[model samples]
Target: MLDPQRTISALRELQRRTGDAQGAQRVAYTAPWHAARGFLTAQLAELPVTVDTDPAGNLWATLPGASDQELWIGGHLDSVPNGGWLDGCLNVFAGLEVLRRLSEQYDGRPPVTVRLVDWADEEGRFGHSLYGSSAVSGHLDPQRAATLTDREGVTMRDALAGIGVDLQHALKAGTQRQKAVAYIELHIEQGPVLERQNLPLGAVLGTCGVERHRVTVTGRAAHAGSTPMDARQDALLVLGRLSQAVYAWTAAHGGVSTIGSVTTTPGIPTSVVETCTFTLDQRHLDPAGLAALWDHAQRDLAQFSADAGCTFAVSPLFQIEPVPFHPALIGACEQAILDVTPQAARLPSGPLHDAAEVARAGIPTVMLFVQSLGGLSHNAAEDTLDAHLDLSVRALDRLAERTITWIRAAERHGARIPAAP
Candidate 1:
């Protein structure tokens, strides 16, 4: 089992050092990623795992198993600007705990090889989540790395240059070894569902798919005080109606939709609104349902534009389908949760994660969520109860043991695992 004290200490150090935006620094490429990477380098030394930087700026810690093949556990170390304490740090430490246990318990000969990866720039602070993980899954283009930049106008190329890794280096890692029988991640629930359910931990029901887009409504800009509302085609007015429709749609659907960012131009609110831009965020567990809502929004956009005598432009922002955890892997996690804790619940992830990238590579993957108090995460206030964290560690141990048992049995028959995918 992972030493709860050690895991807690590791987490504290990561938080104490990095969250401050001082100790470890922001490490956003040319800005502050070094401080972040520096802290990881220091911490992984305790385990003596081989750490390497991939082309896409991923820092990987490999704990060699008895075999060449492996089971990989990963989480990003990057955080949003002034982000939460638990966001990416918890998973990194949790995976480290798994590695620590493997080294101590199995004599470097676990049933399957094990690896712990610390993905860089998963937050897209430099643009793109899973930049590190995506490289491993064979999704990133080496050239695209040069195009990504941070706030200071430093391309990912230049930022990683100081670290001795370029995009060409991060991208060629290859996918043949994506052969892990199963990949798992443990993370704070990032929502209040588990806490509301009063469960310390739970199986992930699924990850929600998100659809984001930019909508521009254009209407004539005229003298604000002179143009009457009944006669004038005001873009801001149309946008207001659009926001109301979005809110109504979210209320009507089982899912949610939001226009988080909106802006109008004229240099003054008192002047007639010429153009308006807004963002729409929609998410749900069902892919078809998400698409239907997306289509619904499109229809609304068209009709609203026509009714308001305005021109509308909708551009795709981000689109991803919901990813369901592997049933078999989830079964192991479910049983492990029950073995380690008294209460367990299942819920969908509201936020995106690396698992979706790995799943796209044809690996059977599952995620486990530890309780986040009040569903609080991504900030200094983000917290998972100590008891919950203990239970979570124990559950990971149980999962590792069960996986070893299955892996060893497979070796007896000259196979790696029962067919997944």
Candidate 2:
């Protein structure tokens, strides 16, 4: 039988082994991350499954069934520096428990194959998130990935070499999905929405599209004490205005935006800023809304810079369109959540996940979200109530069963997997 307590115990054990007072240290390509993976492998030892790591470093544990078509459950084991305990590993351990139950019930053979994937580097310790899943979906560019470096100046190439993962062969990981028909993931909501609504679990609608850019404004530097306010062409002033405008514009467009970083050229407080640079990150579930947000930012930047007698430039850093989950799979998730709780809220994921990459690969995909305490993540303080965690495991198991049924029905009727709505 499926045991939520065992899954919780496993999570606690992993946290005790891999986490410190500072927080979880399972950053990708690190010793702690390897230990976490090893811990998961040990857990799978009691099950009847084949385990292996792909060229891109994604770990797969497969339980063979009568049919070759695969239903995939996945999450990452890697976390950001000082990340929360339940951020990534919860999905893995929960899926592990479900796998145990299925193995015992089916005598290790079910109607279709089930694979649990622990995607490598989903936290992007080297500045590239979804590294493993993207590679498996054929969306990762090896050449560009090789050029990325961490704070220690170690290139992504060298880091992959340390783990015996050849960057050049990473794209071949896509072959692992040859028989995959659908994918599902369980994750912490990492936001305040569910908690604020007094809810325990939510069915994720989809991952939001993102527009990331770096904006730089240049102006003449002058002595702060000498230059009159009217005479000063302060780039910082323009940047500050632009930052406020971004937030206002995003709010008006029903999206979200952040000025995550800022820097000024002048080192001393005595000098008027000559140049300022900042990063703007915008997100929306709708593609048109996202585009409108960016358009507003551009217009505001031009006006603000012109008014300040400064020159401004924008450089695109990254972008991805909104990814909607498969409608049928989403319905399955909602039904599963409803089975465990009185209410099932459907919400878009402002943060990205491996499911988005899988969905983009043309595989049907959906995600379940457990509430996070204090709306926290990527920090030591992030947490969720144990009761909620237990509920999430049960819900995820139900989702798995529903997805299996859906897949079999599709196969029987010769119906193609429905696309995302």
Candidate 3:
């Protein structure tokens, strides 16, 4: 029942509306994002679902069922600057396809309610990522949300109000917790793992725990021409050494660590750098492992910096505990993949997603991944083949169908729902 032609046609229209030479520019709280939201609203106009927006700007289209129990499926529509077309938006539109197909199959109402969502600000361009999902999950810190400012010194609170969302109301929205049984999302692998294995689809095991830090190295500035290599304390050199160490750490260990951005104060060609700052994004599947890695990184990097006559400072940005998918949900997803395709692979996601927040909120959560063409994402060149995308969409539709059956069966027996891991 998954219509590839309809889905692909919708994708073409989205790309035409929101896409540009630089790829998708649908950043949250921006004009393009608002336009894209309007487009989505138009698409849902003919459906039986009731569409509404939360205080945090999350868009929801709810279709009633015979029972009050609900299943939420969604992903963010916002993207990083020059991000790929399919990174976050694929799950959302694909969810719409599932809803459309389900609507055509049922008579008056389906056995279980379904809500398709488009979470806001999963890219975290303002301050923190997963803003909308975090608010929905009741994990948002009011103090933090109240003070977050964007590049132009505009507070997130004002930005939300500009789009008709109140911060206080947003916080309150989490209290109206519907009977959401599970949250499912489909995403591109954004890495080469599935492609290397020649797999079209993979069921996500869980989202990785993350530790983000801003590291600064300070050293005495010296004249580049006058100071000898042994005599000069170069902050840039110290930063280079520390970066290499971090790379080695992740290489030897079984995780991923990245320094995506760097800045140097007094970055003059004729002068030794006085200060250098860089960001660290560390990911691991286990909390214990992530903790150990952080502890060792701080201690070892400090010594490494000191050996180069520089002082090292690390400012913690955020820490997300590892979240594993519920066993029942994982099994359902795996079975759905098998039913749709000849083979399926199991993998853990290194990138954080909105599903992580839903899992934290105690709703069972799982994800599906389509293969990326070359492990590229968050860039204009990021992409996946149409065949791969179509296959993943079909698998997700099958998963949703299976999940409906599971939820209805559980409701029938008055079975106790299992807690999320």
Candidate 4:
């Protein structure tokens, strides 16, 4: 039986260990995250499970079954800088609860192999995101990641070395693994949608596609006071116009566009910027729409730069296409939600997740989201009501049970899961 109080107690313990007054400090590749991992290890110490770590520093604790076919449950253990106590960590701890509960009910062995994972560096401690799940999906390029360095100038290679992950062998690590039949993740909503609707939890439709770019506009620098207004080719001015254009485009299209960072040479009021660079992060739920939007934005930015007498350059960043959840699994989750909270809603995730990577690996995947209080996230105040937390846990446990039964029945009947509608 699922124990809501027990689950909350475990979550509280994790919070105590990894979170402080400032919030969760278990950022990936940091000392606090290692301590958090140690705490997880201790929790699984007495359980009948074989715990292991991959070359990417992802932790896996497996409960053996009759066959190698596995139902995987996991989430990232890492958090953003001073992020909430229950961002990536919530799903990881929820997976732990599933393991603990199932282990007790089944006497340490389930009918199907169940594996719980703590994905490493999902918050991109070393300048990129989705490190561990992408590695497992065979999409992580170790050679490329090797060149990445943290804000501290610490190379990803060196940072990984601290955790015993040899970058050269990272690619080979994912090759030797059991076949995953499905993956389920439980996470906080991280938005206000559910809370505003007075719902405690929801079933995720899918994660949005993301297109990121580094845009650079080059213009001649000059003294701000002395340069003639008509003769000046100020990159900063071009940037301002392009930023507004981006907002306009996104407002018309159904998506989000953010200029996350900006930089300029000789950043002073006395000088016109010679070069201006900014990061563009765009996301949409529809794949084709996302591509079209990006194409339009790129063309607009190029034109804007040319009109301002500035040269334009676009540097492609990483991209993850929209990933829809498995229809059968989503149905299972929806049923579980309905059983607990009949008013629960179905929503698409704007933020990406490790589940997207897992789905890309061709495993059936679904996610459950608990409401985030006041839509607050990435801050110390990020939280869910205790009642909502309990409701989500119960609902997720029901989904897990339902999914296991469905998988077992499918295996017996020699049938494949239904396709998404």
Candidate 5:
């Protein structure tokens, strides 16, 4: 039988063993992460599944079934430095419990194969997020990834070598998905939407598209005491104006924007700022909306810089289109949530997950979100109510059952599975 308490206990045990006063230290490529993976391996040893590590360092535990078609449940085990306890590990442990129940119910053979994946380095400790998932999905560029390094100046190549992963061979991990038909994940909302609505769980609509850029404005520096305020060309002034315009435009368009960092040259207090650089991150659930947001930012930067008599440039840092989940799987998730609560809420994920990469790989994918307390994540204070956590596990199990039924029906009727939008 499925046991939510058992899942919760496992989570608590992992936290006690791997976490510390500062927070979870399960950062990938570190001793704590190795211990966490070892612990997960020990948990799987009790099951009938076979386990292995893919070429990209993703861990897979597979339970053979009557059919070869696979239904994937996945999450990451790695955390940011001093990160929250539940951010990534909850999905894995909860899925582990669900796997245990299915094993018992099916006498070790399900209707279709079920696989649980613990994706490696989803936290991007080296600045590249979705490492393992992207590799398995054939989206990672080995040459580019080889250039990445952590704060300690250890190359991603060297770090992976420590774990027996050769960056050059990572793309071969794509073969692991040869029989995968659908993927589902459970995660914390990492935001305040559900809690604010007094809800315990939500069905994720999709992951938002992101437009990340670095904007730099240039002006001639002058002595602060000698330059008149109105006559001076201050790059900082242009940056400030651009930042305000971003907020206003995104607010009107129902999107979100952040001016995450700002740097001004000529640091001395007595000097007029000659150059300023800032990062702008804009996100929207709709592709058109994301494009419009980017357009607005460009126009604002041009207008603000011209008005201030400063020249400006924008360098693209990263971009990804919105990834909408498979409609059928989304319906299954909604139904599952409704099993636990009176109503099921739907929302778009502003944050990315392994499901995004899997969906982008043309595999049907969906995600379930449990409420996060205080809209907190990536921090020690991140938490969810115990009741909500239990509900989340039950809901995820329900989703798995529904997905299995859907997959079987699709096969029976020869129905074409839908892909991510």
Candidate 6:
């Protein structure tokens, strides 16, 4: 019922107007976010919806249905530095389109309320991924506020303060909604599986577990010309071998892993490198595998460093266990995919998203993934065709309808959401 091409252009422009080469671009509480947030809020007025911001800075736009509260139909709006257009933008815009189209298609609202959410800082510019979603889910510890920092040494307190959000509240992990409802987040697959298979849409299996760490390699700096290879403790060589081992392990395990960022000191050509550090991000479908990997990596650090003539250490930055979306919600997504495109399949998510946090919050949440052109994201070149976008929006609309109906039925029968406590 809508041209997704226009929506994509509008979204891309929103990014262009706000992103910057410096600072964490498009981060929460940043000027770019303000620009995008302002645009989105202005758009909400057309739908005759009521809007408000939550304690954790999550912006909520509500369209009332026959039932109580809202269906919470949207997704995060934050992005990685210079992230692609479709990542979280698709969810927010597509959900808006769903509401608009639903208004035109059906004379009355669906059986339940619908809520559009733009969760703050889903990218966690301060490295708190799912920050907003997790805060609302009562998952973030209030005392951990002191631990977060950006590259410029700006704590979450300062960054949030710049946006007029109080850091103290961000710690509370506020009220969990206990309602007769389900959540459906539509996102790009961010991987090559669907595109390689020529699939237009797919059902989300689940969000994978994540183990991210900061590994530091320390070695003595020496004069480049004077020190022989045998005498010098070169950190880069040790890190190189460590990187290869990490990549090979994750690849062999049917999971995913990578060294996403690398940092080295003193870029002088003549100076022997004194220190080099790197960030290792590892993911898997099971917690046991993650733990095993972490254990092995920790155990190997001593010998690996000794053999490579450097000192290596692995510090656990963050760990999130894999989360399964509700089975019924998943089934509804499958049916919706079949309705829109015949070539849809089920695949687990490699990239972490808000759906994982929502699922952890005890909501019966599920996701529908559109095919990415080259299975690439967090890049300017990431893309998906309009057909795929249309397929995703249609599937999400179907999911919203089914979920609303299910919620109403469940409420009538006194079904309850299990408490996160």
Relative to the true structure, how large is the alpha-carbon lDDT of every model?
Answer: 0.73, 0.90, 0.84, 0.84, 0.90, 0.76
lDDT for model 5, on a 0 to 1 scale?
A: 0.90
Give the TM-score of each candidate. Answer: 0.88, 0.93, 0.94, 0.94, 0.90, 0.92
Tens-place lDDT digits, model 1, residues 1-421: 5786677777777667665742333545534456666776787797747887665666678777776556778787777776776677677777778888888887655656777777777776554556767777777766765776666677777767776776776757654345576677888888888878788888886678889787888988888788788877778777777778877766666577878678787749577778898878889888877887788899888888888889999876556688887777777788889898776777788787888777767776778899888876655577777888877877877776666565556667787675421
Clashes of each: 13, 0, 0, 0, 0, 1
Give the lowest summed-lDDT range of ten residues in model 2: 412-421
- Per-residue CA lDDT of model 3 for 265-352, tens digit only, reads 7888989999998878889998877887787688877787788888888876667899998788888888888887898899999999
lDDT of 5 by residue, 39-67 (tens): 99998999999999999999999999898
Question: Which candidate, 2 or 5, has the higher TM-score?
Answer: 2
Q: What C-alpha RMSD separates each model from the true structure?
A: 3.1, 2.4, 2.3, 2.1, 3.0, 3.2
Which runs in model 6 stand beyond 4 Å of their true positions?
1-6, 12-16, 19-25, 103-109, 171-173, 417-421
Best by TM-score: 4
Off by over 4 Å in 3: 145-154, 416-421
**Which clashing pairs does model 4 show?**
none
**Order of the predicted models by TM-score, top scorer first:** 4, 3, 2, 6, 5, 1
lDDT of 6 by residue, 288-308 (tens): 877767665666666678886
Q: Residue 124, candidate 6: how far off, in angstroms? A: 2.3
Write model 4 residue lDDT over 176-293, tens digit each, in one string. Answer: 3447788899999888899888888889999999998878899988998998999888888877987788877787788788888899987888998999988888999998778877
Clashing pairs in 6: 71-113
Error of 2 at 191 (Å): 1.6
